[model samples]
Target chain A: MAAAFTAIGGKWKLTLLYWLAHGESHFAGLRRRGAPITPKVLAEQLRELEADGLVERVVTGPVPARVIYRLTPYGATVLPVVEGVRVWGEAHLQRTDGQSVSDTAMSCASSIV
Target chain B: MAAAFTAIGGKWKLTLLYWLAHGESHFAGLRRRGAPITPKVLAEQLRELEADGLVERVVTGPVPARVIYRLTPYGATVLPVVEGVRVWGEAHLQRTDGQSVSDTAMSCASSIV
Candidate 1:
């Protein structure tokens, strides 16, 4: 369980993977998705994901290279867990609607997932 | 997604819930389970879980005050996500056997889960 968390445990890693699942994206594109993750942290998370073999970083072009990230085959294996969390999060939001939700919860609820 | 993470996203919260699922335990009993979590942290995690309504804390005695923790019916709803992470962790360990795994991964893999 720790291994799974180690790979995707960061607050934004799974969210990053979820975005990648929809389609590949450059770092800038990901940053624009609005999770409030700093560039340093985002780079770090993506690097760790790559090292864990769950995400691949592709650099294209000689000048002004575009670095794209996507899930690896091994990384794809974790989609079920990510999807599970997403589904549960959606349910939880409805379940607790009108209840006070923290900024972290609100940000992660609609945008992060 | 963030809501779910906010509820049970602590390093040891889900594991604590998993242990509680098997049976209720006091703070000391949980500390003995061997996760290396400090008393302060364990207490805080349980408190958060309690506040989230996923865990129920019962005071069983007055003089000694045995505090027992267990999963509420709502707490049980998260078992599937926890189980999914566990299964993925187990598979990840097998998939990467003989490969380098960090201390965090090893600790969370066998003992924490």
Candidate 2:
């Protein structure tokens, strides 16, 4: 329960999954994508993802030691799950203010400002 | 996708879901459950859930106006998805450190401390 949810629930983690789900990318390449996290955080997230078996790490050791990451078959399974979330988001996109869920209601009820 | 993900992704959201999945509760009643949040935050979350149609709010007027919230049929759909996450979490519970996901991996690899 916690694992899979945590897998998708990581801050900037979902975005990483969204990107990796597109295809594999090396560390620098991912950083260039302008992820909303620092390189240290990014690398940390990727490594953890790898250990959890949700991602595959390929290290090409020749000189600079290139390390690339991709989602595993299990990670791919989250597509439908992620898709489920995406569907929900799309349907409520306007009302959700792109934040997904009903944050709007709380925004209305509570003055978090 | 974003909507559903965000819905389930809210802090204390899943915990709320777990509680609602079992039964309904009101503002003060829920507070006594030892939720790891403030009364203000709980009411805010519930109101947001109500607006999202995931929760039905019952307001009884007389004095302070008691408002009790319960999950709606639409909100019920999230059960399977949350269950999916739960299954994933339980499967990896020990390794997950109760924080859910593989946060431990990052702890091991990156040492957030």
DockQ of each: 0.38, 0.19
Q: TM-score per candidate, in order?
A: 0.75, 0.58
Task: Report the C-alpha lDDT of model 2 over A1-113, residue by residue, as the tens digit.
Answer: 12334565554555566667768988877777643458888888787778777789987776464877888987776665555544554555555565533443211121111
Summarize candidate 1's per-residue lDDT along A2-113 as a digit string, tens digits. 3444556565666777777777788888887656579998899889889888899998866454778988988888888877776776666667673344554234444322
Q: Which stretches of candidate 2 lie over 4 Å from their true place?
A: A1-4, A27-48, A61-65, A94-113, B1-4, B27-51, B60-65, B94-113
| Model 1 ranges with Cα > 4 A deviation | A1-5, A62-65, A98-113, B1-5, B36-41, B62-65, B98-113
lDDT of 2 by residue, B34-100 (tens): 5356888788877777777788887776545377777888788766666655555455545545553
lDDT of 1 by residue, B1-113 (tens): 33444566565666676677677888777877656678887899899888878899998986454778888988889878877776776677667773344554234444322
The TM-score of candidate 1 is 0.75
Looking at model 1, give its docking quality level. acceptable
Q: For each candidate, what is the lDDT?
A: 0.70, 0.59
Model 2, position B109: C-alpha lDDT score: 19
Give one clash count per candidate, in the order shown. Answer: 0, 15
